[model samples]
Target chain A: MGDEFCSCDILHENLIEIVKKKMPQEEKLYDLAELFKVFGDTTRVKIISALFEAELCVCDIAVLLGMSQSAISHQLRVLRQARLVKHRKEGKVVFYSLDDEHIKTIFNQGLEHILEPRGFEHAVF
Target chain B: MGDEFCSCDILHENLIEIVKKKMPQEEKLYDLAELFKVFGDTTRVKIISALFEAELCVCDIAVLLGMSQSAISHQLRVLRQARLVKHRKEGKVVFYSLDDEHIKTIFNQGLEHILEPRGFEHAVF
Candidate 1:
């Protein structure tokens, strides 16, 4: 989208102009990449999946996932720092859950695609 | 769910039961992570964002992103491998676009969370 004088034009100019105007800025792209990076781990995804159904404390997550408490806590801290999960204190215990609808939406939508992709399933393979 | 008798119980048993029931299997979790890892790169995220707006060929993408054609092709290959994008040939030229609605949904939803977080934005810092 730099200018009208660049050489490549595989798409319609109007469409290219529109896309250039709407495309995310570099910083936003970086943040977006960073956000996905948090989700790009098996342990973290599992944690988010577990929290999708209900809130759970660190100990509970460890037990459910069959991981050590310290390891679970480390991943939770990453999720917490990324604002993917929220925690509330109940006495000495802190429980965690999906931060908001966005996490669930991302998880559920991605899953929907993985499990059921109308016609594109063939292209994926 | 592993069993009915694990020690930690910060949440209701019924809720734990449900999350365990719904949680993705290990293979799916690994796949999910792999899918996201592809998104975790800034150049790749920018590529997807550009595609989100309109389909374009490698030369156009390289020009638009101020990157080399080889670099753009490399990321396009990665995106192709992850099934995040699709391509078609028109004689000597090939074009690419977001594979399906899943990518669009994932990108839009994540953007929404980042731009407007219903008062939870503060926790992200």
Candidate 2:
């Protein structure tokens, strides 16, 4: 698959046409990359799931995840910065919830894909 | 935000209610983390964007991104294994496209979040 991927075969006409018509700008590509990077963390994803169904404060998140309050706080900072979660203050407690539906959409979709009866991601074995 | 997040304050009543109702299982959290991790790479994100709009062979992907066919092919393997993209062969050329629509939804949502008029990810961010 390696060298073959670079093989000097004549280019496919359809591929060439599509590339010319649909190529994205470099900055948009970079932005897309950064966005995915935000999702790539284990702790963050768990935090996201915890927040998916309810708004939670740091202490609440910590307890739900079986993590320390300090740990939940750190990840929440990352999530808040990524715009994956938003918050409001009630007295001194900051309640965090998913910023939008995309988190759940992506999560559920991925889950569905993996859980498909056929296999996990086209046969992990 | 630091120490306060860990303060021994009694948990808020609403928070306890939500956490109890919403906490996810551990294995699901791990799987969710793995899913997000798949999205968290710059090169992979670009590859995803390109495929979002077109079915591409390795050479084509390399050309569109000004990358080596070898490099694009490497990333394609990762994408395929993750089930973020799928491929088919026509003669000797293998073409790749997104595995499904989740990639697009997630990407578009992140773009919308960051590009919001007020600011990015909570002011500066």
Candidate 3:
């Protein structure tokens, strides 16, 4: 696994170098920017947080969050498009959860940092 | 530490409820959205990566990244404004590094998840 990660670092290094030479054209930067922009919103973050605990239908999420169904639906749509969350339908209700377990690592780790009193004394060397 | 995180979760629950009851006004979401927006860009991601390892000034970064001095400077300014990076002046050059080691925890953790083979096989319990 460490070996594979080493290869991935090499790839990332090559890619970063390529990006530097190209002067960061707006189109690519815009796409990348859009992805990061998704992370910027607190509403979406809250929605993801709620989803982290259980697979919830939009209405349940709305109730749990005290948000309107319409508002929750809109944010969920954005998350869906970004591949951040996926949903399954059962009868009239749709249940939403994280698209992948890997993503939860990001959210959970971020939350840990934000919520911790002292930051990150626990990294594996 | 775990207890504090548990308390943080309670706080998050209360906050989420308040946000939900309010119907998610655009004003609040916008601020949240803007922060997510910043994370969306690839160039910014690259800049963050370069700084992750060591402190480098604009010129060295420009060389290492193959990006223009102006472009790197601009992105650095944005990162600074976001409190993601801090710079120190030494003679004619300014050296920049990750603002707090806490952030590298985020970046390193994210990259590890992204670049690893199966993703997050080693998360601490």
Candidate 4:
């Protein structure tokens, strides 16, 4: 199946050279993949989506997500470690919010991809 | 560890209610995570990055990434399955490119997150 779809004898040498030059460093690409992996989990994605609405304490996030505070906390730790979220202290309570605006932009971009009409379904395979 | 950081006795009922209303459906969030998971792999990310430069056949992508054609084809199949890439047949060669511009925007957003100075590193823990 693989060969049938992509066994062209002639490689596009010029195109490959250009793309290789433009490709990010291998380490950067690995880090980028690691960052996206943080978003791949449902729990973390929920935490991120909730943070999008407003900053919230762990208890609030747990209640909102209908999950245990521990479970939410675990995911929050992962998110914080990835720097996709940051916490602020107000008196005794710690509130979590997105690390920066770029997170929201990234989430919205992903949402747009899934929400948009996927016209490629009918493309020749 | 979890409790120390988030044992606030009072849940923010009002905030939870508001965010709950604004939160996307569970199915949508699940789909969103699945979509991001497709981008969470190093090979797929490289494939997407290459397509960002120019459309190319599987063999070209294999050469550009310094991977076997079979490996590149596998990742291309995953990308195609997720609708992150679309392919066209020119004669006998199948050339692939990003499904839409949202992919590039998404990649840029992720890039910005990693490239930006993360001020949250110094945030109070």
Q: Rank the candidates by lDDT, best first.
A: 4, 1, 2, 3
Ranking by DockQ: 4, 2, 1, 3
Please tell me the TM-score of chain A for candidate 2: 0.77
Candidate with better lDDT, 2 vs 4: 4
**Candidate 4 lDDT tens digits, B13-57:** 777788999999999999999989999999998888888888888
lDDT: worst 10-residue window of model 1 chain A: A1-10
**Residue A86, candidate 3: alpha-carbon lDDT:** 78
Chain B TM-score, one value per candidate, order as shown: 0.77, 0.78, 0.64, 0.83
Best by TM-score: 4
Query: Alpha-carbon error at A21 in model 1, in Å?
Result: 2.6
Q: Write one digit per residue (lDDT tens) for candidate 1, span A1-125.
A: 44334445644566667777898778888888998999889899999988887889887888778788888899999998778888998887789988878888788777776676446544545
Give the lDDT of residue A47 in candidate 2: 78
Superpose all Cα atoms of candidate 1 onto the true structure and report the RMSD in Å to 1 decimal: 4.8
lDDT of 2 by residue, B1-125 (tens): 45444453364656666665666667766766676676777778778877877777778777766677778788888778777888889887788888766667777766665566654536662
DockQ of 3: 0.18
lDDT of 3 by residue, B1-125 (tens): 22122233353465445545544344544544454455667778767766755666666666665567788789888777656677889777687887665565555444443444432322335
**Per-residue lDDT of B54 in model 3:** 60
Candidate 1 vs 2: which has more DockQ:
2
- Model 4: native contacts recovered, as a fraction: 0.69
Clashing residue pairs for model 4: none
lDDT of 3 by residue, A36-82 (tens): 55666777877776676666667666666556777878988887766
List per-prediction Cα lDDT, in the order shown. 0.80, 0.71, 0.61, 0.83
What is every candidate's C-alpha DockQ against the true complex, given to 2 decimals?
Answer: 0.46, 0.51, 0.18, 0.55
